[model samples]
Target: MSQKFPEVQGGGSLIIAWQVKEKNVLVVGGGERGIQVAAGRILHALNADARVTVVCPSSGLNDEVAFRIAEKQVSHIDRNFEPQDLDAADMVLCAVDDPEASTRVWKLCKERRIPANIADVPSECDFYFGSVHRDGPLQVMVSTNGNGPKMASIIRKKIAGTLPDNTGAAIENVGLLRKKLREVAPDLKDGAKRMKWMSRVCESWSLEDLVEMNEADMSQLLDYYKSGEVPSLKAIRDTQ
Candidate 1:
């Protein structure tokens, strides 16, 4: 008999890791609170490699926004949002203090089928920005479905504290090893073997061991893989 599966109960937003590299992101803000909100959203968009454009008046800009604009990290439209502004927007973050303007942007985005987040208004948001803890390429996000952002931030901090400082470095080392393994064993038939080797390496080595592995150690790993063996952490590091 097949194993029984647990029943599902769904009532929450779908969490996903979105890759917005080189995509167009529109950030709308105005007034004091709006600019503060816009600054954070702009930073995140830039970090994601999105082509960001902020729509706000000069008076609305905070120091961070002013600095980024001066640095040419993002383009600026020194005016309130217009319907034409949504023309090339792949995604939108609406944080304007003006409720009417926020609603208008949300409505237009809905009609255009662009995903949008209307700050602090769960009903209007197609997605919520969770509190995130980042370490190099690693990112851990916590969400309360836009109900408790402050609580999410607190929880993220707790989680971050428990992780090792060199966790990201270990992950980077493993990634490099994967690439070398692929080059040496570049056959469709060896896919499962490669996966097994990687899994064994991760399981056998401590975080510090993985972090200390250099390019020479990586080459040693490939040598062991060719013989259908996963070497101990000491064995690989000894080659260096």
Candidate 2:
């Protein structure tokens, strides 16, 4: 099967959210640079139950890789990479310092129809890693499309500083409200009615209000919805 790359818009790279859970990931090289890339992949995979394998000569293995190996978080092959290493890999990271090896890995991955990321070699990479900021269930990623990684990091830091600490909590409360709505207003299952009700609820409750709500407040909100009372748009606007 041929791989379909995402379309570029406005001369910028296309951004996407990929699901890597339970997938096989291959990391070639275990030096300082390679360790950094592998560490990120391992962290992302930890919560998703994905499998990660690192291949690098023992002499090139860094302390970080050694520690992860000792902890049994990822499987490792203490030797140089081989062409067959690309077999069964859903994603591959080529971080070796040798340009020849990196090029070979990239070519093999392309032949096998696997997505590959070659560190510092955007031309040979299928994708580039972006700077990510995660807050509980909320995750924000910033990417410069391999044009400027340092700028992406700076932007990520700026955005992370502006987000409220309770942002994640607010999202969780909204989720709870959604579940209650399904039970309390089953009759409002029609898409329009449901959307309007949800809009009212969202407007009536601010992020701070949602984060500060207790069990009593949640029960009261459910009762209000069950009473089939829709707050007037004027009232919603006034709250805003």
Candidate 3:
């Protein structure tokens, strides 16, 4: 088991939020079960603005995979995996039922130093797609390294349940407010001041209040930041 999962030597893998935008992702296979895995990876890549190429027999494709190809959302190869497929691939996702084929893909990916995930074969995977909860720009991922996937999912749900439903909107509004604040105080020397002011604002506002914050409220907040003052709740509401 330790040989199968090298990370066991050091607790677990280090989790990170990878940026795959504009990168090429090679997806292989679309068998009955493979279809689900392929479709998921395809959608996730597209969501990250990554270029996707699906390599699978036409008959093996599921409705979702076929629909994506029909809509020109991704390029399709309509054939089995080939060594050349990894030429420009930043990553690979193999979901074929044939263990040999999956292993071959993993070997090629390793040769090229490209990360790969072979469905249902955690031993060959360079990465794991753990349970994730996404809310606008906020994403929380729960990983159990390759063990207890269902447990990871349950924990993810409990974590998500603890957050307010509108938490995403609040975060987005705060991000926008942060941009406006930067514009109002763009001097490099004021970085610490800006951070402190933003921290104060975040701590003082409720989730609902942050969600309802408008351009006027942001402008008033900037005024307070500029004057080195922290606005009271009443002062913030007066702007509305």
Candidate 4:
């Protein structure tokens, strides 16, 4: 007999981390609010190596936008948005205050099957821009499914405060350890066994311990993995 999965029933937005690297993103607006959104998109593009273009009629730019432009991080077209602008865009952001213009962009995105977000107008958007918290490579985004952005911002701030400062470094160290472990041990070729071993290693070390680990400490960890000798909780805690 086949198993039946439960049907999902909700109006909530599906949160996901999109890979925008080396992709084209279009922002249709360069006003105050639009510039703010464009600034964020540009930063994301910089980190992900994506290409960004902002379409607006005004020469005036916010300080952030101006800096990114000067740094050659983003391109700007000084003109009103045209339907043809959506032609090679992987994603689009409609930040124009004009309802007609926003609707037009939204419709074009839908027709083209491109993901889009219309600033402050959730009804016309395929997605909402949520508040983000970053700790190195760890990124957390919070949203209220377009119902309450202010609330999302508040929650994101609270959550950000709870994260450890060395989260990014710790994650990188773990990646290196994982790579080393795979290379040294051919016996742990089974995916499940590898996962179990990783879980055990993580259980022995706290976030602080992982952050404090240097080259010598990583060498000791590799030794433990090879010898099949798990370090005591007290020994691990002492490093912190």
Candidate 5:
């Protein structure tokens, strides 16, 4: 790892989000690292349907996660990871066999907000992804906080192993119900009222009962807000 890659920053603006959604992605490397990374890049996409292009002369996207990638799949460049790699790429991942080459790629990515990940070393990466679990539109992620990746991996496996299969579905329902609550009241106090509705929804409904919860009430609230009407909470929730 390069000394330039610090454990933490003293004073600098570090980015915490990505620019890719309906955007381009590029990965360079064909070995195990490249293949895994290529798969991951496709996995985290907000718009999992966006196009991704991988350029590694020796390797390409693997079949293991090909179905997921195919849904938002990547195209292969069939060439060595070169400076020209970024020309067509929105973000880059350097999984090359060469450390120096990876470092070089890191420099270019750093110059731009274009997210980059260096497989040879975590410290060199602009950002890293943690193992994630998803249910419908809900997601739970486990990040290492750029500390001990091995420990993070161990914890992630523990989480994934222990989590109930219905956990994600429950969370998704909560999110959907929250949207409904907001719709029912136009001038509901911002913080607690919104959060309170979510709390009530959780308390009132079982994970399985979420599907049976009425969306019409929530929809009516949102519709009232659109019509410039702000109803009281009790009126919206109980009296309708």
Candidate 6:
């Protein structure tokens, strides 16, 4: 609360937001921590439709996540890092526990004006990654804003349990309803209306409740979810 940058107040977690949406992220580390961070990078990138490139030496992980990154078409540099490694990066994460190396990466990023997060050293980070829970594309990132990572993580787990497993399935059916509504509802083209509909659907029909419904039921559900007017049929015909 006192600082401009988001950081875990206890100093273990740094809290900051990096726009991983459609932006490339470079995670530099090869240990278990590095692998953990890389997975988040991959999921966030997949959700945001972004690209990911992982940079690390081959010494750390006994597992195959490093291999998976290559197989997944995520860009990878399978060796030690150099200062030039950061120039083209949109966001940087120094996940190694080694202070000297992370410091080197952090300094270079700062000098080059790139955003970087230093793991194991919250005070050194520019941003913090929080615990998250997702329902289909309904993703929520929980943070103490860096004040309390444990608290943030606890809240995320609690929220996760409340979210039904079939929430993701219901989301897909709603996606179809939205596509059809976009065609029929011209007056509802307002951005606010559209966002409100999404929020309303999330609240009313609710992802948890819709899991039992089939496709036809979902479409009908969305219809009743929208305003009763349903726009003019002439509006639908005009484009044709």
User: Candidate 3 lDDT, tens digit per residue, 27-64?
Assistant: 99856888888898888889788999999989999999
> Residue by residue across 1-240, what tens digits does model 1's lDDT show?
234876665868889988899999999988788889888889888889999999999888899999999999999999989999999999999898989889999999999999999988999999889999988878999999988999999999999999998999999999999998899999999999999889988998889989988888888778888677877778666656
Candidate 3 residue-wise lDDT at 33: 86
lDDT of 6 by residue, 39-147 (tens): 6655565566667776776566434555556577577777877877776788887666567888888888889888877776777777777787877756777876557
**Which residue window of length 10 is worst by lDDT in model 4?**
231-240
Candidate 4 residue-wise lDDT, 1-240, digit = tens: 234876777888888888888899987875666667667766765776779887876574778877776787788877889888888899997776677778888888898899998887888888777888877778899999888888999999999898878888888877777787787676645566666777887787788767776666666666667555667545744664
Quality of model 3 by C-alpha lDDT = 0.88
Q: TM-score for each prediction?
A: 0.95, 0.80, 0.91, 0.85, 0.68, 0.69
lDDT of 2 by residue, 65-141 (tens): 77888899888988999988887799997787778878998888888899999888889988878898887678888
lDDT of 6: 0.67
lDDT values, one for every candidate = 0.90, 0.77, 0.88, 0.77, 0.63, 0.67
Candidate 5's residue-wise lDDT over 91-185, tens digit each? 77666667887888888888766678887477787677666666666555677666666776787777778766676666765677565655555
TM-score of 1: 0.95
Best by TM-score: 1
Query: What's the ranking of the predictions by TM-score, best on top?
Result: 1, 3, 4, 2, 6, 5
Candidate 6 worst ten-residue window by lDDT: 228-237
RMSD of each: 1.6, 6.4, 5.1, 3.6, 7.7, 7.3
Judged by lDDT against the true structure, how good is candidate 5?
0.63
Count backbone clashes in candidate 1.
0
Clashing pairs in 3: none
